[model samples]
Target chain A: MRSVQIPISDETIRSLEVGEPVALSGVMITGRDAAHKWMVDTFIKKTRQPEGDDQQVYAALKPILAGGVIYHCGPVVAGLDTKDYRFVAAGPTTSSREEPYQGDVMRHFNVKGVIGKGGMGPKTLAACQEAPGAYLHAIGGAASLIAQSVKRVLGVHKLDFGVPEAMWVIEVQDFPVVVTMDAHGRSQHAVIEAQSKSALEKLLAA
Target chain B: MQDLTEPILELVRLTSTDLPADVEQALRQAVEREAPGSAARGALETILKNVALSRANSTPICQDTGTPLFYVRHPAGWSTRSLRAQIESAVAQATAHAYLRPNSVDSLSGKNSGNNLGGHYFPTIHFEEVEGEALVIELMLKGGGCENVGAQYSLPHSQLGAGRDLAGVRKVVLDAVHQAQGQGCAPGILGVAIGGDRGSSYYASKEALLRKLDEPNPDESLAALEARLTQEANQLGIGPMGFGGETTVLDAKITHLNRLPASYFVSVSYMCWAYRRRKMVWKDGQVSYS
Candidate 1:
C-alpha cells in the first residue's frame, strides 16, 4: 500500500494508478451536499459575496485546498455540547452526489485528490486527466474503522451547514482508500457500469 | 403502555452499532468468494473490522447513522400518540449519545434540527394496531446513499419489453440493480415490492428489509423470485463498492400487495452492506431486543 501525505505534489498525485491501495495520512476537509453547493454558489460561481465570516473562511481554505484532499463525508460527530468536535464515526458518503460541482471545485481549488465512495462520473475523471489528481474510493459504512485513523481534529467551519455537512478539517494517519478514478482518465466505476449494463441486457433476454 | 423511550433508545443504539449476525455472515462469505488481495476483499475486510470495533466500542457502525424509521405494532388499547412521542424522544437521545447522526433538516429553511428531531416525517414512525398483548418496535436506519438509488417501475412498459408479469418484474428489478452498480453500496440487499399503489409499494419494499438476510419467504413463489433475483444480481459483477468483482447483492427480498386494476407499481429499496436494523419487543411486562 502506498502512503500519501498532505501537501502532495501534482507529480505524486498523477503517479497514483487506478485500483492501487493507498493509505492517506494528512489533513483533509470534510464536505458534502450542502458544503459543495455552498462552495459552488458562493466562491466558484460568485453568485453572492462571502457574507459574515465566509470571506475569512474562504481565505483560510484556499491554501489548504491547493494541494489537499476533500473528503465526501457526513460523519457522526462527538463533543457537540462542548464544541470540541471529534469524529465518532467517519466514512465516505456516496461520491456521485458531488458530480455536479466536483470538477469545478477541483479546478478552482487545485485539489489534489478526492476521498469518497462509489467513484464519480466523467466530469471528475476529466478533471483528474486535466490536472494531477485521483478519486479515491473509501470503504462504505466502515465508519468506526475509518475514524480510528483520525489523529486529531484540526478545526471546522460552517456550523450552520449542520454537523455532518460542516467542513471539518481533520488530521488523519493511515486512512485507507482505493484509487478508482485516476489521473490517466480511467474510472473503475464507468468500467463496471458498462459491464453491468451488458449483463443486465443479457439477463433480460434470457 | 409504559414509557418506551428508554427502551427505544437502546434499540437505536443496538441498531446503529451492532451488525446483525446474518448480514455479517453474508459479508464473510462474500470475502471468501473474492480473490485474495483484491480490492473487493479488502473493502469487506475493512467493513468487518469496522463492524466489530463499532460493536465493542459502542459507536455507530456507519457515520451516516441514517434516518431513524420506527415501525410500531401495538395492542388494541395502546396509544399511538404516546408511542410517537416516545420514539422521537428516544431518537433525540440517540443523537446526543452519538448512536445517531443529526439527520433531519428543514427543507425550506436550510437548517438542521440539530437533535435529529425535525417535523412529522422525521424519525418516521408508522404505527399499526395488532391483536397481541405484545408491543413490537422495529427500527431501520435507512442511509441516504442506498435510499437515493431506490427505483419504482410501472409495469407493462414498452421500453425494455417488460410486461406486467413476474418476468417483467425480474427484468425491471435487474435494471435497477444494474443501474445501482455499487452506487447503492454493493453487496446490497434489495427489498422488492411487486404490486400496490405508489405509496404502499415503496413502504412495503422498505418493510421487507426488516426480514432476516437468510430467512425464506413464506410464499413459495416469492421465495423463488427472491432467490433468483439475488443470484442474477450478483452476476452483474458490480462487486463491493463497484470495483467490479464477484458479489454484488447478498440477498433479494420479495413482497407483494394487491393493487388497483389500473396500477401495477413495483418498488425496489436498496440497502447497503451495513444493513442496520433491530427490534424491541415488550411482552409479559418485559422488554427484550434482537
Candidate 2:
C-alpha cells in the first residue's frame, strides 16, 4: 500500500490504477446529501460560488481532527443540555447511498478525495475524472475504533442539520484511509464485483 | 429481579456506545481468523486498534451506531412484568449519552424523530421464552447497509429447479452478494434462514446472524453447507472492503426448521465486515455474559 499526502494532483489522480490499495493523508471537507444539495444548488446554479479547488469533501455525517485526514463517517450523537454530548456509534455508512449527489458535490466543492465505504457509481467515477479527484474506501463497520484515532473534536458545526448525520467541520490527525476509487475512473469495487460474478457464473455452469 | 432499572440503563449505554467484552473478543478473533492479505489484514488491524482507542477515549465504536436489535430469551415467570418500558427508557438514555446520529426521520414528512425513537427505533426487541430462570439478551447493532441487503423469497422446495437444491441456496447467496457488490461493505457474512413462511424467514436470518461466529451449526447437514459456502464465497476473492482476495466472507450460517410441504421460504441477510453483536444472559433476575 502506498501513502500519499494531500493537494492530490491531476497526475496522481490519473496514475491511480484499478485494484491498487493506497493510504491517504490530506485535508478533507465533509458533506452528505443535504450538504451536497446545498453546494450544487447554492454554488453551481448560483452566480456567486465560494472558492473550491482541489479540496476533498468526505461524504461524511461527522467530522474528526487529528494529524489531517478526512473520514467518510456518520456518527450517532446525542447532545447534553446543549453542548456536552457523546458519540455512540461512529461507523461508515454505505457510500453508494450518496452516489446520486456525489459528482455534483465534488465539482461544486472542488473536492479532491472522498473517504467512504463501498464505491460510488459511474457518475461519481466520471466526476472523479472530470474534477480530477479521488475516492477512498475506509473499512466499514469499524467506527468505534476509528473514533479513538480522532485526537480531538476540533470543532463541531451544523447542529441545526442534526449533529451526527449532518455536515460538520472537523480536523483530524493522521486519519487512515484506502483508495478504492481514483481520479482515473477505475474502481476496485466494480472490478471485484465483476470478477466474483463471473466466477459464480462459471461455477454455476460447471 | 434486581430492580433492573439502573442496570438495564447502564447496559444499554455500554452496549450501544462501548464495545462489550464478548464483542471485542469476537472482533479480534474474526480479524485473526478471516482476514487474508495486506489490505484486508491492515484494515482488520486498524479496526481492532480503533476498538481499543474507543475504549480508551470513550467514543462510540462506529458512527452508524445502528438500530438496536435485541433478541431476548426470557424465563417462564419473567414475562409476568413488561420490560419494554424499561428497555425503551434505557435506549433513550443511551442514545443521548452515546451521541449516536439521529437517523430516525418521519417517514411521511421526513422530520427527525427528535429522540431516536420512531416506530421501532433504538432497540428492536424480539422476545422468546426459554425454560430457565434468567433472561438471555442478545444485543446486536444492525447497520442500515447490511439491513438493506436482507431479502426474503417464498418458494416450494420443488420449485428450486435442478441446480437449486441446498447447493442452489449457496449459489443464490453468492449471487446476492455479487449483486450487492460492496454496497453492503463486504468481506462480510451471509445468514440464511430457510423454512417457514415470509415473516419467519426474515426473523430466522437475523437470528442466524446472532449466532456466535465460531459456533458450528447444530444440524450436521446444515453445518457442512455453512462450511462449503464459506470456503466457496471466500474463494470468489471479494476480499476485505471488496478489494479482491481470499476473505470476502468470514463465515456463512444456515438455520432451517422442519417445514410444511406446501411452500418453503428462505431469507438472506448480509453483514458488513464489522458484525456487531453480543449476548448476555439474564437469569435468576440477573444479567451475565453468555
Off by over 4 Å in 1: none
The CA lDDT of each predicted structure is: 0.91, 0.65
TM-score of 1: 0.99
lDDT of 2 by residue, B69-172 (tens): 87777777664246766676666666666634456666676566656677754457888888857676777777788788776655523332324357667666
Candidate 2 lDDT for residue B228? 84
Candidate 2 differs from the real structure by a C-alpha RMSD in angstroms, to one decimal, of 5.1
* Tens-digit lDDT track of model 2 for A83-193: 544444455667786787777766765666777887888998998888877787777877765543444443454444455455555434455667777776677777877
Best TM-score among the predictions, by candidate number: 1
Tens digit per residue, CA lDDT, model 1, A83-148: 887889999999988999999999999999999998889899999988678999999999999999
Worst 10 residues of 1 chain B by lDDT: B177-186
Residue-wise C-alpha lDDT for candidate 1, range B138-199, written one tens digit per residue? 99998999999999999987787899999899989999998888888789999999998999
The 10-residue segment of model 2 chain A with minimum total lDDT is A60-69
